[model samples]
Target: MKYDFGEAIDRCKTNSLKYDFIEERGYPADILPLWVADMDFKIPHETAVAIKKSAEHGIYGYTEPKDSYYRALSGWFEKHFDYPIRQEWVLKTPGVVFALSLAVRAFTKEGDAVLIQRPVYHPFSHVVLNNDRKLINNPLVLKDGKYCIDFDDFEKKIVENNIRLFIFCSPHNPVGRVWTTEELTKIAEICIKHHCIVVSDEIHCDFVLSGHKHRILSSLSQEIADNTILCTAPSKTFNLAGLQAANIVITNPELRKQMYKELTRTGYSQLNSVGLAACQSSYEYGEGWLSQLKEYLGENLKYIRHFLAEHLPQVKLIEPEGTYLLWLDFRETGIEPSELDEFMKHKAKLWLNSGEIFGKEGLGFQRLNIACPRTYLEQAMIRLKTAIDSLL
Candidate 1:
């Protein structure tokens, strides 16, 4: 059951977004890509075996998920987090991002105000604007390099704008934070008071680090659950994002009805045969693989912490309670945004997500994907050290 995470798999010729799109991304070809959210590791062996078996039939006909697929989806939730999700509550979707847009269309009006925390996943804003909904920013507060909800500001925005919906990022991205039960309670109260429907994106829920547990926002209370639309997938956990599968869970009967109606209106298609096979195999047999991978990622985070401390002392490493993405604060490096981008591209030969893409709050911050082989990580660290040295 020992997985080979250290092996450098060749991904250049495979039409990889992380590899083949460098020129399109306006970065030098030699720059190592650490920008995309997907990891460089091979998909789980169990998932691969299942996919191959499903492909052997050689018929890519239209398909619907069998009972086993439903069981796998519900069983994983029940077994791991003890969250009981009935079969009736689950709605299949091709992608979480697509689901977000669908939820916006389903629940809100064209001009309805949708609130999103700043320095959040970039797509949250993109989807809202594209769907003709007014975007409201309730930026997270940076206190001691740890990000927390500005609840007072959140309440203010809800009241001031008559915000119709709130899109939340649990165990939030970039500045990784697993919102505690108390925080969730307060947030749920505010959303309820404002009569705002909540769309909680918990896609990265399972990849949390030690001492942190993911709290499903809807599970906190019945009223909160009624108004909440929960989105999740096995993509990040099992490294099967290419499978193009995700679940939209709504426990409230009326809300579920509305979402399904929207799904049909949008002409949302059925899940692919391979996606179903991969999801079943991953949910059933990929737990041990995930557990070990988390351990490896913990070590990777620790290595980055030490590297920054010993070498690039000017940069701040915000310790994450969840997710493999390391949010680096390079403000102290005093490099302009353009100069920093150049350094990462040319001098360091690394490609990380520019924080500015997230929001203005992300200025001088960069999100580094550390979910790769140790050798690759070490090389990236060396490049980072050299970049800083050149600046000095």
Candidate 2:
């Protein structure tokens, strides 16, 4: 089936955080928003039908996933990445961040140091700090326009801080470099040697661009698998964030038990019926839609690259290898890191995730979600070019 990637959809007044809450979020009412991670596209047709069917059943009571759910979930990982999943290893959660918070409480005590790579998804830091754990950052280094991990610093930070828990963003958020196998191996070896538990967020695993591949951290080896907690969900892939379903894969029995106990302590159980229905059906039947979406996104990426070079030369696009979010560097425009937000909001009349929110390393940078129609990007680029022109 041919999907309409350019279809127009009105999201305003739908209680959308990205659309309706602009004024509440301290941005001008008329500013176009491309900040939040959710896509502007609609969910796949199969997923919608499954959700509608479940919703019409009338009993929206607490629910647990059956064997069919496990088959569909495991089937996806096996089919796409050649990573097999065991039924017992799966633990359903409300979302990945929620599961991360539970992992923080499960794996480490208060004041224990937890490590993360900076300029990552902000919620990583939040899960650590809000849980009363000490936060340690090993910031990624930008080498020749691509982000790379400083392995020495990563290991040193773990030893110096006595870190036991590390949150890793795979195919990384914001600055989108998919980790090669060599990179994944070194990380796994260091974490294993240091006895640091790795909570690997592979939420964007399915969105790798052409010429790159996403490797599951735990799939490296049995030793690494024992020390890893893999976080995944169909929310980002299928545009079902509102449904609130995530799968936390833990190969280590003890670690799985610990996290599940912490989850139970919070009195949270059973994913919503509609979310379960949507997730299973999407994984089972939405592959055709996803394939076409990736192709559309690839074109959007090309358009941005050409648009920036031709018109907005001052803005540097940090070439992305995965995910729809593009990290844009505005430092060349001579805009002070502190003033970039104001400039984007008031001058450009646009709403994007300020780089500083990710970390100090993100200063003078902005994360733009490009999972919308090409027309949206066209309008955003015009507004940005006009804004930059006014500065001169």
Q: How does each model score on lDDT?
A: 0.88, 0.94
- Badly placed stretches (over 4 Å) of model 2 are none
What would the TM-score be for candidate 2 when compared with the true structure? 0.99
Q: State, as a TM-score between 0 and 1, how close model 1 is to the true structure.
A: 0.98
In model 1, where do residues sit more than 4 Å from their true spots? Answer: none
Instruction: Give a tens-digit lDDT track for model 2, residues 1-392.
Output: 88999986999989898898877767787898899999989889999999899988998887889999999999999999988899999999999999999999999999999999989999999999999999999999998889999999999999999999999999799899899999999999999998999999999999998899998998889999999999999999999999999999999999999999999999999999999999999999999999999999999999999999999888999999999999999999988889999999999998999999999999999999999999999999999999999888
Worst 10 residues of 2 by lDDT: 21-30
lDDT of 1 by residue, 1-392 (tens): 89988889989888887888878867777888887789878877898899999999899999998888888888888886778787888899988998898889988999988999999999999999999899999999999879988889999999999898899998788788999999999999888887888999998988887788888887887888898999998888887778899999999999899899999998877999999899999998888888888888888899999989988888899889888898999888878865777778888898999898899999888999988998888998888888778876
RMSD of 1: 1.1
Highest-TM-score candidate: 2
* lDDT for residue 360 in candidate 2, whole number 0-100: 94
